[model samples]
Target: MTLEASVVHGDWEYQPVRLPRDVTRLNATAELGLRSRFGGWELARTLLYADGTRKVWLRRKLSRMREGAAV
Candidate 1:
């Protein structure tokens, strides 16, 4: 997952920001109760904020492999 932020006025420039991968892990463990059960995540929903920002929710199963894994 990726995030992009941009200035709404003046230069109106956009920049890519880096987020910690642990966010997904934390959400899975704390919110979804999948701490020891899930191996991956999937996008569940998205919300647009009034400040032109977005929030996303994700979910995953207990036994699914990540994409492009060697079998």
Candidate 2:
């Protein structure tokens, strides 16, 4: 998966996820769950298009993270 992430606001970082029309609901939920389970990501926003494609945003708290430093 490609990551298109940036600091929007607050103490959180966000990633945008795109689910194609062919993906099933169960698969999508599992995918999101995996992100949360292993990547500390949470659902931030979602939009479902008329063509069945979905756009999802996932966010995780920064918690005092610093660039070039191990958390």
Candidate 3:
């Protein structure tokens, strides 16, 4: 899996590296850039907003019940 990201700022080209797997964590720098440093976020959000993205993990059903469990 390969990740790709690109951005444009006042005719300046910006390309950032993305990991090829699901991110287990987001550092401060990554969070900051995503929140305010990049312009492509709006475009990316728009694209994703229209097309539903899948959640990484969700168990379908429970096989056995533990004590004091609801399900």
Candidate 4:
């Protein structure tokens, strides 16, 4: 079996003026983590307030098929 790996990223911004009052600023990171996990991604790194926004890095492996002549 051939294996392939890829990195995924998720980001969220906290806009005090545009976002709803019920939205917590700290929850941005948590939300990103949960969403990534739900998509079968593993958390690789957490960047808080990087460039004034929350950033998350995730990684996952997948199976790849090789093109070859059938025996």
How accurate locally is residue 5 in candidate 2, as Cα lDDT from 0 to 100? 53
* Clash pairs (backbone) in predicted model 3: none
Give the runs in model 4 whose Cα sits over 4 Å from its true position: 1-30, 33-37, 50-52, 65-71
Model 2 residue 48 distance off true place after TM-score fit, in angstroms? 0.3
Q: Model 2, range 20-63, lDDT digits (tens) per residue?
A: 89989999999899999999999999889999888899998876
TM-score of 2: 0.80
Model 3 lDDT per residue over 4-71, tens place? 44433443333333332343335523643563444332212211123332122111222234212632
lDDT of 3 at 51: 33
lDDT, candidate 1, 1-71, per-residue tens: 36554222232222233334445545534643442245244455566556554455544432224222413
Greater lDDT among 1 and 3 belongs to 1
Residue 62 of candidate 2: its Cα lDDT?
75
Q: Which candidate number maximizes TM-score?
A: 2
Best by lDDT, which number?
2
Q: For candidate 3, what is the total of clashing residue pairs?
A: 0
Question: What's the CA error at residue 16 for candidate 3, in Å?
Answer: 3.0
The TM-scores of all predictions, comma-separated, are 0.32, 0.80, 0.21, 0.37
Q: Candidate 3: lDDT over CA atoms?
A: 0.32
Q: By TM-score, highest first, what's the ranking?
A: 2, 4, 1, 3
